[model samples]
Every structure is written in structure tokens, then in C-alpha cells.
Target: MIIAVGSQSKIKVTAVKNALCQLGVKADIEAVKAHSAIAEQPFNQETRQGAINRALHTAQLVPRAAFTLAIESGLYWRMDAWLDIALVVARFPDGTCVEVESEAIVFPSSAVEEVQRRGVHTWTAGQVLQEWGQVQSHNDPHLSLVGKSRADFIQDAVVKLFQTLQARHLLSV
Candidate 1:
């Protein structure tokens, strides 16, 4: 079986591979750079659509892929504070899809505000945090804040997505 992942990020690719391995799935994994077409700091619905777009976009790029997967992380405003979550969307060849999210973590409102204030389309929440010495960089952010690697969140989300699809009998692979 061939699985295509819509991301060039090593963390995401490895997380998906790790999740599939934990599920006892053996297949060829492909990673492609696909745009999410959402805001640099996606929130709410943008997060969901970003994941879906990545999955469909990757599937379009890799026609022979048995399954296509993509992961998107964004913040949600709830109870006065912003919560960050990772949303993973997986698509089957027939255009069927399932989605799952990682546990939400607290995101500093200051960072969100800074990004919003900058009004730059290229700025991300992570980058804002990085500038303020919150994290090392835009790549592996969870480590400093949550003490968990971003890969951990993505891996868990992928597993949840896989299990959800399996429970619904939506995944044949």
C-alpha cells in the first residue's frame, strides 16, 4: 500500500509513519509539499479546511496513493484564552475522509495578538512566540511550552484518525 502525506515537514511525516507502524501497517510512505491555503495562524474552521485541503491536494498530486493524510494545527478561542490543537485529516482514494484532533494546549494570547497586530500574512503564532523568546523557532514549538514534541501531538492525532476510520469501517487498509 502507498500512503501519501501532504507535507514536507519531517515531524509530520515521521509522526504519520510512527502512527501507521504502531497500527502494524507496513506500506510505502510519500511526503509532498502541499499548500493548506489558509491563514498563517489558522483558527477554528480554517484549521479543519486546511487539513482537508492538504489531504485532497496531496491525493491530487499522488494519484496512485491508497490513502492521503495531512495535519493542521490552529488555535481556538474558548473561555477567554486561546487553545491550540492539531487537526489531522485522512482521505481515502474515493474522496471519503475522516478527521481527528490532538489535545488542546494553552497558547499565549500575547503571541496571537502580536501576530494579529503585525498584519503580515507570513507571520505565524509560533514565529511570534519565537521572537519573544518563548520558543526556539517555528519548527518544534511544543517542546519548550508543553514539554512534548510537536510530533507527539501529530502522532496521537493520526492514531486517533486511524482508529476512528477503523471503527467506522471507513478504512480498508
Candidate 2:
């Protein structure tokens, strides 16, 4: 299967490929440069909108791909906590469409308050991690603890997340 992800970020591409591998699916994965104003703040409409925008944009760019995926992670605040939820919008060559969603990882109140106190508000998950001290120990400050790379401490968390998604059949059509 050809899985074309609509992002040039190597971290995201690796994560998606690894997630697919764990699901026992062999796919030819590649990254494409697609731009979209994806709202980082979690809301159903914004989440779906971002995914759709990217999927369509990338599909237009890669007309020959069998499958394309535009995945975005949005963070929503709920009761003094932040929830990290993933949204994926997929399209097949024949115009078959599927939308798969992942549950939220609730961040502690302390983390949320610290973020707001810093006056650093951004929808990007990488930015949120930097606002906190999560990247302090890493040599590469931009690397996400919850993203691609095996040495990341958050690998287990990510793996468990994808497995959960698979178990729920979120990856299936």
C-alpha cells in the first residue's frame, strides 16, 4: 500500500510509518509539502477542517498515490486540563473517504496553568512542549518527546496510543 502523508516533517512521517508497521500493514510512505492553517485549539469543526484541507491539498499534489492521509493533532482545554487529540482525514484514489479519530491525552492542570502563565499560546503540539521544560534535556530542542524517534521517552505513550487506535479499528475503512 502507498501511504502518502501530507507533511514534510521527518518526525511525523516516521511516526506514521511506525504506527502502520505496528498495525501489521506494509506501506510505501513518503512526505509531501502541503500547507494549511490547521487550528491547534481543539474543536470538532476546526479539527475536521484542518484534516480535510490538507488531505485535499496533498491529493491534488500527488495525483498518482493510492492513499493519502492528512493528520493533525489538536489540543483542547477541559476543566483546567489540556487534552491532546488526533484527527486523521484519509482519501483513496477512487474517491473513497474515511475519517479516523484518536482520543485525547489529558494533560495535568499544572502543565496547563504553566502554559497559560507563560503567555505562550500556540496550537502546535511541539510549541506546547517547548513552553514547558519537556525539551530541556534533549540535544535537539525541536524534537518532540511524544513524536517519532525511538530514544524519546514518550515512545511508549505514542505506541500505546496508536495501538489503542488500531484496537478500536480507527485505522480500518
Candidate 3:
């Protein structure tokens, strides 16, 4: 079996691989450096759509893969704060699709502004945090601010999405 991932980022790729293993699904992964065609730090529904776009793009790139996965991180404004979340999307060969999101982390206003000032098209919050030495490249910054690793949250979302697929009879594992 094969799984196609829509990113070359090591963090995202590892999260998907870890989720699949935790769920007892064994498969080879094909990682593609896909462009979401949106702001790197997408906001609102753009984040979700970014994941979908990536997954769709990966499916096109690896047509024979059994599944395609994508995870897109973005910020949403709610309850007077900026909520940073990673949205994970999964696509099956039969056109089955499902999505789930990591639990959000509240980013301090300064960090949010720093990301905004740097230009969303050019930098993601994680990259800004990386510049500050809060995290490594392509890793999440929530650990420094909210005590949660990027991979943990994203892996959790992927696990939930795959389970949803299984429950819906769209996936066997």
C-alpha cells in the first residue's frame, strides 16, 4: 500500500506516518513538495481549503497511491485572540475526503503581529518562531507558547481523520 503526502516538510510527513502506525496501518509514503496556492499563513477557511488543495494536488502527482494526506496550519481569530490550528485532510482513491483539526493554541498578540508584519506570503508563524529559536524549521511553535509539540497535535488530527474514514467504511484501517 502507498500513501501520498502533499508536503516535503519533515514535520508534516512524520506526523502522518506516526498516525498511520499508531492506527496499525502499514504503507509506504510518497512526499511531494506541493504548493497550496494560498498565503503560507492562511486565515479562516482558507486554511482548510489549503489542506484540501494540497491533498488533491498530491493525488494528481501520485495517481496510484491508495491515499493522499495534507496538513495546513493557519490562524483564526476568535474570542478576542488568535487561534493557531493545523487542519489535516485525507483523500482516498475513490474520491473520499475527510478533515480534522488540531486543538488550537492561543498565540500571543506580539507573535501574531510579528507574523503579519513579516508578510503571510513569505513566512508562517512557525518560521517566525524558528527565527526566534523557539522551534526548528517546519516544526510548530506551540510548544514554546502552549506546551504542545507541533507533531503531537497534527498527528492527533490525522489519527482522528483516519478513524473517521474507517468508521464511514471509506477506509479499512
Pull out the clashing pairs in model 1: none
Top lDDT prediction, candidate number? 1
Query: Which should have the higher lDDT, number 1 or number 2?
Result: 1
Q: Give residue 63's lDDT in candidate 3 (0 to 100).
A: 97
Once model 3 is optimally superposed onto the true structure by TM-score, how far is the C-alpha of residue 4 displaced, in angstroms?
0.7
Q: Which ten residues in a row have the lowest lDDT in candidate 3?
A: 134-143
Q: Rate the local accuracy (lDDT) of all candidates.
A: 0.86, 0.59, 0.84
Q: Flag regions of model 2 displaced more than 4 Å.
A: 40-44, 77-80, 108-129, 132-173
Candidate 1 per-residue lDDT, tens place, 72-108, comes to 9988887889888999888998888877889888888
Candidate order by TM-score, decreasing, is 1, 3, 2
Q: In model 2, what is the error at residue 139, expressed in angstroms?
A: 13
User: Each candidate's TM vs. the true structure?
Assistant: 0.93, 0.62, 0.88
